[model samples]
Structure formats: structure tokens, C-alpha cells
Target: MSCMQHLVALLALCLSLAAVAASSNHLPGGVNLNERFFNQVRALIKRRMQEKNCARVHCPLSNVHLQPPLVDDEVALQNQRSYDNVPIPAASVPTPVLVENWPTEQHSFGQVTAVSVDPLGNPVIFHRAERYWDVNTFNESNIYYLIEYGPIKEKTIYLLDSKTGAIKSGWGSNMFYMPHGMTIDIHGNYWITDVAMHQAFKFKPFGSKPLLTIGKRFRPGSSVKHLCKPTSIAVATTGEFFIADGYCNSRILKFNAAGKLLRTIPQPPEFLSLQVPHAITLLEHLDLLCIADRENMRVVCPKAGLKSSHGEGEPAATIQEPDLGRVFGVASYGDIVFAVNGPTSMLPVCGFTIDPRSEAIIGHWGDFKNPHSMAVSVNGSALYVTEIGNNHQTNRVWKYVLA
Candidate 1:
């Protein structure tokens, strides 16, 4: 209660408050700690110099030296040379090395419609027109004679050795009108579908002659037994073949190994808006058939063994526009199903893969001017895409390494 006791209590309270402020300064991210350290070091140097009447200014590399001297083991250990090393900057990523020209074959024949590997692993490429001849135009040269517009001339297919990169053999008789699709079965046989001719022909592997023919002439729905411009095809593991009876016809024709018309899977009328069904593939695991409905810009799956239109049950799932943008080729390999965008100069050659579980487009790759056809490597690591743009007389096949 006395004045002296009150002054003593007030002084003690002020000192305690100053100590609390000093303790808080030691906490992380505190501005006062740095300020106090610098201020104390300046004051110490100034006092020492003034007292010693020293003319030189003293400076220490670190402000920690300004702290009170202590012989504690912890302080000595902390003062020892720090083992923490300064971080070095990371190196830049290296650029990818691009392989020069690949798929070392050039075909002057019009848009290569289909390519298949024979029993010998040789690639058989089928094309519409023959090579144009300049120097041999008038002469009866082999190149000029094969492509001349004479009554005996027609479209043809050539077998190229995969390793030697040479056309081992080729055949074009008076049969083909426009050979648009071809496939080699395990039996080493060759099957070709002629679009303009409205005919399907099966030939012996090395046999130059046709063993069987389906249609007599070009006619839409001429008979369920015949096919009209069947654009794409797939032969299932069971030896059962499927074809997209494309162009003028909206029906899908399925046949047996013996060339018998086993069944017809027609498109839904609801998707009548999708007139041109370009490609077809049988996802055997799901017992589902996927058709690339090109004009409608989507992929439609009509369950296998269906006889008539079911009115578009579902697209398996719709592909978002511009993303699916006129998908022309549909192929399923392993967990990845690839579809290539149609030839649009604006859109690079892009492909999309669906995650079967989610049926979602999970990955995409671009760098094609006009990607026409795609084939997945047996191992599924590389994808071979054919580009047919810029009046390309000789189409280029690109091999994309997938991640």
C-alpha cells in the first residue's frame, strides 16, 4: 500500500513485459529477432571502437557472433561448421530425338485403303488407283500398262516384305473396281472388299487368282447376300468376320469363314442422321460391336447377334464433339481403344483411347496432318498411323511411342 512498494511492483511488471517480448522475438518468422540482432551488433561495435578510440570499423560475416559468450556444449556444437550444403540448381530436360523417315515404302497408288501382315509378316497394301506414268506414258511399260485406263485395268494389292522393305509380289486382274479393304486370316488367305465394285473377293495367300466373289455389281441393298462399299472390316478370333456395309448402305454384314452370310447387324434408325459408318471392330470381351459412325461423329456399338435396328440403345458412350471430330478409324488393342480423327487440315492427326472400365477418353496424341488408318503393335507399345494429306502421292506411316 505504500508509494515505494507500488513503484517496486510497477518496475518488476515492466521488466517481465520486456522479457516476454524478447522471448517472442526468438520464434520463427519474427521480424523483431533480425532487427534486435542487427541493432545489438551495431551498438557493440560502436561501443568497443569508441572506448578503444579505434579508427577501424569491425564487421562479422554472421550476426550470431554478437550474442553473449557461452562455453555450453550445445552452443559450441551449433557454432561448429554447418554440415547442411547449399542446393545446386537442377539441369534442364533434354530434347527428344526424332527418328528420320520411317515405314520406308512409298506407293503412288491412290489412298492406301488397307494394310495387313501376312503369315510371313510381310505388309500387304491395297490401293484404288495405279501409279501414274510420265516417261512411260506412251510406251507399253509394266508400270504404264498396269495403271492404264484400258478395259483390262483395275485396282490391285501388293505384298511388301516387312524386313526387306520390298514389294515381293502384286496382283491386279480384271476383277477389282476399287479395293478399299483387305485382311489376311491365320490360314494365310487374303480377303479383299471392293467398294465401287460392290464385291468381296477371297484369294489364296500367294495365289494370284480369286477363289470366291460375293457381289456381281454395284447396287445398294441389291441383296442381303451382297455388300455395298464395305469400308472397314474385322475378323474375330473365332474366324467370324464383320464388315461395315458402309457408304450408301447403313447395314453391317457379318460372314463366316466359308463366305456365308451368317447375319446382318443393321444400324439404329434413331442414328439415321449418321449416314456413313466408316469403320467396324468387334470388342470380343464385351461381345460388343463398335462402328465408327463418321458422319454423325460418334462410335456406336450394336451388340453382336442382333438381326434388326434397336434404335440406338447407347453409344457405349458418346465421344465429345471436336474431340471425336469425325473419327474415321476405330481399333481396340488391350485396354486401349484408338480412334483417329478424319482428315481435317485444321485438326492435327489426333487419336483417342478409352479406358474400358470407365469408357472415358483418357489419353490423346497429336502430330498428324491427315491420319487415315492406324494399327497397334502386337505388344501395344507403338502405334502405326498412315497420313494421307497434301496430295500425298506416297503416304507416310508414323510410329508413335505410347507411354
Candidate 2:
């Protein structure tokens, strides 16, 4: 059939589907498939048109204008706009020195998204293989168009020796689309999130099959049973966990041991709404949950056990220092919270050590190009960071030891 015929048929199918949904009142999962469904259909149609135009010109639109052009002065103004009056931290924590010649072998990766140290001190890495998230990656519904791009067949998970950066073992082939956050629980269970899949999975250590999975596969919704682009997972000893429902839904979700939804944790009133709870870490000792609120460019901490009605509560503390600079990931070692931020127009990419109690920036570190997620060692002696790199050119797993 011609393109015009296909478009007409699609529109007719959409109308029929809408009518059926309206008559049923809601979808099978109790999702109100109303205007949102129509919006998704429209977005799909628009994307098809854009792709056709690009094909006609023999140029891919996805390669054009990935980032907005900014002049030096504009970048400087944006970097100084938010925290001009805030005082920079004076006292420095123990400097973290990069371990040279680490990861002993040269291995190529595609957008390493997350890294965590296992109980045996091996750094487990979650990467995207060859898949890349771009403007056309997801539709308005936040569901990845996987039919156009097949699932990655390569193993996306890797375990490396902490001392030598040598591969200990690797698994997770034919699994995961866009690997995001990952964590190893006390019981040796691996918890991971996939933004493209819109779900979180719990796997037995070194096992390929998921022991438990959260969210409907490839379906994005605000309902309790569904998650839109989940970014991070933080699990407790008791098996209770929290997930950062990222990108589209900017909120934190809590679940019980058996993968049952508990409730959505409320963001602080100060943030009328969270832009992106991109990464989250639990401070078990301090009984606090800290999140890297990415677009807000701050770290928000609230009492881990605090409960409120209808997702409303105040944070125990927050860190919004100028040096914080677009936090992408947050990790905690004891009471001190560590955060990594990508570069702005003016500032270079760096990380910060914050005293959560005082909400002060205590220490600073640099030398990262595009740090996505980070993890501190069990003994607090070393730090593991995964960088997505620019255009997936420098996908690397970095290790730093306290000096």
C-alpha cells in the first residue's frame, strides 16, 4: 500500500481503538486510555513523517542538533545564574586518585550506564551494548519503539576485578534494552532498571533470568503496576526497594520484598515537582533516601521511612550548591553523600562530596567527561563510576581510590 493509504488506515485504526476504550471506560490494567493514547498515536505518525523526510534527503535527522549551540558568554551566564551567592566548600575530603592501568584489558562498550561493587569486591557494570537513546528513541507515551530497532543480543552485564579491572564474568545476553541503574543487595541479588523496557528486574547473582520484574514490559504509565523509564534501583537488606521512575514520570516508587507496590514517596514541597529523580541511593545508617534531582540540579534527601498522604512531604535536607552542577547520579558512603554532575556551558564535568547533615559541599573532584552513574565500595576505600561518554565514543568504567 502507498504511504497515504497507510496513514489513512492508521488514523482509522486509532479512532476504532479509541471508541473501544471509551466504551470500556479503561484498559485491562485499569489505565484510563483516553487522550494520552491519542497523543501517543499522533506522535508516532509525526515521527514516521520525519523519518520519511530524512530518507528523501539522504540525511538522518537524528544526527542533527543533538545539543543546543551556546556561546562562551551564554554558558558562563547560565552556570552562574543559579548559585551565585552560595559559598563554595572550603574543607576538602580525601582526594580520590584515579587508578591507572586499571581494567587491565581494553574492552569496548556502548554507553556504560551503571556500576556497582558486589560483596566479593568485583565491579558489576550495566551497559547499553550498541543501543543509543535519542530523540526518536521513545514516543510520547515513553515506550521505546523496539519494533524498528531490535533488542540488543549481546551481554549487557559484566563483572570485573576491582584491583586489576579484568573481567571476572559477564552475563545478561538477549536481555535489557537501555541499561540504567543497578544495585547488589545484601543477599547477593542484582537489581537493575531499563529505561527502554520501562521496568526493573531482580536477578540472582550471575543468573540470566530475572527472579522478579516490576512494571509492564514496554508499557509506560503512571499507575502503580507500571513505570515510565525507571532509572535507578536502591534495595535494602529486607528486600524492600525504591526505584526512580525517571525521564517521563519524575517520582520515586517504593516496593515491598515480594515486588508489591508500597507507595510513592513524596518529593519535598520546595520542589513544586521533581524534574527527574535520575538516581537514588539509600543511606541505611542515617535512615535517609537521597536522590539526584537532575534537571533541578540538586540533591534532595528525605527521611527514608517518612510517610505522607497523596505524595506530599518535606525533605529533611537538600543540597543545591553552585558546584553541584546538573547532578546525574548520587551515591552515599556513611553519612557523606557523593554526587556526579555533567558539564554545563561554563563548568567542567565534576563530582562533589556533600555533608547531608549540614547540606554543605565538603569536597570536590574532576576529570569526568559524562559520568552517568557511580557506586562506592563496601569498605568505602574505592569508587566505581560509569561514563556514557560523548556520542558513545568514550564509554568507560573508571575506578578511583581514596588517597
Candidate 3:
């Protein structure tokens, strides 16, 4: 994480906002284009989406850079408060069964980035077995990864049976350099993202060939046609989808079933601080747009209107737990919303939940060092989670039988 680079960007935003406050009016025109500027722009959007739209939501705008419990708070570092360690009711508590024998020589996922399931309840997992999720900086380098793999296995995408936890099929070994997020459409098509490759692919039902591809592979830009390290994907039943362009850009890009850019959500100027939208999930029944604003350390549920057209959403609610760390991968089923952490978060509790009705913290668990990605069953009876795996940590995915 480039804290210095993003903090420098926040400094620029502070200066700009100070200028606006001095003027006693709306923001001025014509700011320079740079990392700091972009950082603040995303930060600004994150702020407005949380504050402006609702009276019940009580979260204060937390500047990702200046806040105490933020990135490198020395106080939090020395004696970090273990806020989420309390035990939940035993009946509601989940017991995990780790899936084993991955094809890699290490028998681990390196760093499992995303996981989901099909209509038949088959689990689909994506991981960076050989590469790490990169920061926003434009890198042309050839070294460093989340996990270094040996010469044995290179494939990172897989489909597994839920009954026996057996690998059904595996492909994309030649495609992905940094596997990040995966989702299954209603039609059983696979949607996957590769941050290093800078592209999103949609595959036919259990087929290796891509039926559609989004973003120009290996190209990064701000235009609608380009994507910058998109972190997660949300696909609606009608084939309209949204992408959380987190690392480089902080806006949610929506597209139609035909792959044409339909509309962008939450324009840039609306946020106040740190809008790294690291994960996204849609609650279609309630018209909710849940986003894991990673650096801001909270989840923003915008009242997105799901009609065929694309546009901004009303600020419905913002949920933040002090011990949440950095919210990354998220999944929604029925009334339950599940979220996990990024690489850099308070490790004691890697995953947690939220009650959509009352907007309250339920608790956190998943006895692992890091909950890299997560998925929920359609009926909300099961939860699948993964963690960062290395020489020290076990490479495994857990099936939490939810009650």
C-alpha cells in the first residue's frame, strides 16, 4: 500500500477543500490531474455518498489519511483495541471445514482473492497463487507478488463440487497474471477479473472460451472504455453489471448485457475522503448497492435504482465497525450481508456481518489470519471464505455452515 502517495493526495484535497471553505461556496474549477488529485476525488465521492443522503446514518466523514485509527495509527499499532473478539451465541456460530488438495505444489491458493457459487451450489474460487494484488501506482516492473509459486502449478481459477469439495474443472492458467474477483451470472456464465491484466472476462457455462470481455486488456485509463485494477464485480439478473474500479479509479462502472458502457455511479465530486471501493454486492430485492470502501474502513449502501437505466443512487445508509479494518470482498443473500478484509486490516477478526434492516454490527469470525474473499449461498445457509496462504499459513478455503 502506497500510504505516502495517497496521503500526499489527501493533502492536496485538504488544501483544495480549505480553499473552497474560504470561498464559502461550491468547489472551484480546474484542478491539476495527478495521483493526489485522483485520491482526493475518490475520497470526496466516498464522503458524500455516506453523509448527504440520509438522516438516520450517523457515520462521520473519516479522512482516510488524517484519521487516528487509519492506515498507520501508532496508537492502534501498539495496543490496538480488540473490539470484535467477543463470542457470539454458540447456535449461530459457524463451524468451518477446510477444502484441501489444491493442484498447486504448495496445495494452497497463495492468496485467495475471490469466491462464489453457481445455481447448482458449485463453488467457484479465484486466487493469486503466484501474484499479489497491486497498489494504485502504475507499475511496469517484473517482480514481487502476494505469493510466489513454484514450477508445479500455474492455474488460479477453479470450479468445485459442494458435496465432496472436489475440483470439477480448472482453466485460465495461461490467462491471468493476478487473479482477483469472480462471480457467476444467473445463466451459469463466469465473470472474472485480473488486475495485472486489466481486463474482465465472461465465460459460457463451464466453458473455457470467453463469451464477452470488458476493458482493454493491459491498458489503464480514466475513460469509460478503460479500467484501473477493478477489485470486484456485481451482476444483476438482467445481465447489467457494475465494477468497483478501486486501485486506480474509485467510481463504479456499470455496463449493459451487451458490454456497452451504460452509466457510471456516484460522480467523483460527491465524495470527501478515501473512496477506494474495493468490493461490491447488489441486494436486488431491496435496491441496495453495497460497496466496500476499503481505505475508508466502512461499507456504503447506496439506494441504487435498479431500473434499466444507470445513474447515481440515494444515500441509504453507511455501516462502520471500529474493528472492521479494511472492508474488501462482500456478498449478499436474503437479509444478510457478509464482508471480508483486505491484506492490511486488523487481523484478529478477518470477517464480519451486517443487518440490513437495522444497520447494526452482528459480530466477526473465521479463525484465520486474513479473510481474502467471501461468498454467500442463495438461501443464506452457507458462507465460503478464503485467506492468504504462504509458507507460514495454511492454504485453504473454509465452508461455514450458517444456521
Candidate closest to the true structure, highest TM-score:
2
Candidate 3 steric clashes: 8
The TM-score measured for candidate 2 stands at 0.73
Estimate TM-scores for all models. Answer: 0.61, 0.73, 0.68
The RMSD (Cα, Å) of candidate 3 is: 13.3
Show where candidate 1 strays beyond 4 Å: 1-99, 105-107, 131-155, 163-165, 267-274, 305-320, 344-346, 377-382, 389-394, 401-403
lDDT of each: 0.55, 0.75, 0.65
lDDT of 2 by residue, 248-347 (tens): 8888888889988776766343443678998999887656789999998899986666332322334666887443568998887777788888765434
Q: Cα lDDT of model 3 overall? A: 0.65
Candidate 1: C-alpha lDDT: 0.55
User: How many residue pairs clash in all the candidates, one count each?
Assistant: 1, 1, 8
Each prediction's RMSD over C-alphas, in Å, is 26.7, 17.4, 13.3
Residue-wise C-alpha lDDT for candidate 1, range 1-403, written one tens digit per residue: 3322332344454345445677575533453544543343355444433423322332221221224435579876575322111111112111112234544665555556666666555667776554332454323211222233542254366766554445678876565655666777657677777665566777886566688777655543536776666677777767777777787676677777677887666534333344577777666655567767888777666555433233222344344433356777776665346777775423344666643333344444555555656655444445555655334554555555555
Clashing residue pairs in candidate 1, if any?
349-368
> How good is model 3 by TM-score?
0.68
